[model samples]
Target: MPLLFIQRALMIAAVVSGLSACSLRSSPPSFTASGFVADQGVMRVWRIDDGQQRPLVLMSVYSPYSGPGTISTLYEYQNGVLYQIKRTDADGDRDSIQLRFTVNGTVSFMQRQLATQRQKLSNDDIALYQYQARRILEVSDALNVGRVRLLQGHWQQGEVKLCNGEVVKPGFDKQAENWIARRTTNNHQPVSLAWLDGPEGRELLLVANDDFCRWEPTKDTL
Candidate 1:
């Protein structure tokens, strides 16, 4: 499938991700907007707009949505600060993004993961990957966030310059855990990395990075 279509699918999935707490990780000891349980670990979910809740005990949480190489999101609070993180996977690649907001909803920090995955084909000795590079921006007075593409190319020829100005070369930094940007073409065009340790396991991070860098987007033909 075209990479664009897959990316669009992920973007849409993120918006709809704010599902009823009951549906995701369906049965947690506490699945409130303030916090929830995941795989025996407790992750505090802070409401971007307000703050109110009680201490939660750890419990087992069951995940209902399981799509290999799909997109998902997680919210957390630290030191009374609210943050949002999103993860997107494609083919065999996984990625994510983290956004920390102020009490009144001002963005304080942003970190995004730009990644690709290579999986060995059952019928062939070679492997292939699908790259889905996207942007997650702080919106609505930083009370919420939205996702859009910065650059996306698949196959072995995929390449993009992340929001941080780091370039994910066609096949640079290829490794088992994830791929990294080792080179840049600066093709008069630009685009978008990060890894995250989740409660269940480690997942790659996705979204925008307006914190460490300031590489803006430009129109380009893929």
Candidate 2:
């Protein structure tokens, strides 16, 4: 089956489970991390919510394994509704789009920057942005309920020091552990790992010698 269809099916199942859980529970986590594999690359998501389960912010980073540069998008919510969307590309072009919506979903502000030129987005472009924003929210909600989590940590000998400073053995499989060990051996430096945890299994997303914490967003930044 196509990936899109599979994703939608997962989202439907997750929504049902989430609703049932909500009836019996108070709320989901105030902060959560999740991700999904898209056709182009892997997309990691970070979400922050009010204690009551209303989302306050959602951010995603898309990193292609090859060919394309990374892109990041931030979605801010007010009163449980999307208020602003900001997207940036890390390529030489430096493409970016910013849109602010009114309470009624009207675009109150919109800006697009490509390279060094600033341009206005057409009506179709604005609509597409709105659609993408909603779609991402839906995907995020599904991943959260499906128990898919994104974890980041620094690798030490056979263990990982998580972003929160907790040191623990990661649940990665032997092959993944071997890969990390080999990369560390080759780099001669501390390596960082980002992986997705879910009911199905764990999948490695990134392995780099760079400091993952340096660019990671804190609650204050959101």
Candidate 3:
């Protein structure tokens, strides 16, 4: 009789374990990275490339030890609503307005709805306003750092606008490459701007104060 009782207990235990495993399997996916994990709810994100479909980047945050981690993610469009949800550890709550996904290793940037902003044609206006706007967006997207460090690669000597609206020209000294580009206007002060090499020196990469980042569109639905 003791042997029969033991067998019945083992059978019940197996059934309970199986049910628990099934429950966990049905739960939502968790976004995990080094020293960070984001538990997202009710949002389905997908990854697509070359017509193939997969789960898109679901979670990204700045690493605690390193500089701010930039993660970019793409979401599915359901009924014309952007469904990408961003979760982070900094706020101690999930962020609904801005969501991020990992594209490459430890590098992510802010993406905007291209439909919102007007792509103006004036170089001077772009240099002043547009460049700074993009840079500010990048800073906002960054997780931990209030002011990010700029690593503007050297191109050539040129004139630039400083945060104080002072037009500072780089003389023959190539070592004066370390400077910040102010992104916003204060007391009618002009936002700063910098010029860098672009495409055979015909084009220029404008670096200014604010968050200027690369946002690439996703091509698939998963």
Candidate 4:
């Protein structure tokens, strides 16, 4: 009877947890050098214009802890509004484009559809959002669907407009390289991510490990 009870309990657990017995043995992915735990993927955020250090994304590897454990996410901002987000977890990955948001608020895995219009460039030609949401919609759509992380091997490089309206190329630095190496050696960090320079010069940074980060420029900066 005890043997039957144990088997039944295990089966019940699999259903309740939405995981199979075979899957339980599989470990979640994690980064050792960049410190991205498959269970603790997150986005780190900072207002480059402000002196305050705000870690919004847990995935940055440098980002302070936040959001649901095991959820990986990225963020992008336009005019201080966090309108776009991409995230992943045990269930899978998803993108959320919000038309509305609360002040300094965050979201889970819900997604929003972009209202676009087919523009007539010529009698025989048409394009998406030639007029509608042109300023940001196109830019948002052009971004990569998903960025694995700092140690995923494929590092991404690009221009990021800081909160101060200053455009800078953000990617690997000597400090990060050394930091990652040391962490890997000590087994304190495991994930891989790119270290980017912020608009404030070499002293500051915009980490691109977890995903995209939002740069909230102040009124004057805009």
TM-score, structure 3 vs. true: 0.17
Which is the leading candidate under lDDT? 2
Q: Against the true structure, candidate 2 has what lDDT?
A: 0.77
Candidate with maximal TM-score: 2
Q: Give the poorly placed runs of model 1, Cα more than 4 Å off.
A: 1-67, 78-81, 86-91, 116-222
Task: List the lowest-lDDT window of 10 residues for candidate 1.
Answer: 125-134
Candidate 4 Cα lDDT to native: 0.29
Model 3 local distance difference test score = 0.27
Clashes of 1: 13
Question: CA lDDT, every prediction?
Answer: 0.29, 0.77, 0.27, 0.29
Query: Comparing candidate 1 with candidate 2, which one achieves the higher lDDT?
Result: 2
Candidate 3 lDDT, 5-74, residue by residue in tens: 2233344334434434434333222221111112221111122212221222322222211233233322
Candidate 4 lDDT over residue span 1-222, tens digit each: 012322333343334244223333443232111221112222222222122222122211223234333333344444444544443342223322222234553332233332342222231211111122222222111111111112122222334443334454545457755644443563432233333221222321222334332322222322
Model 3 residue 70 lDDT score? 32
Backbone-clash count (model 4) = 21
Tens-place lDDT digits, model 2, residues 22-97: 4344445778887766655667789999866778999988777555577888999998899999999967578999
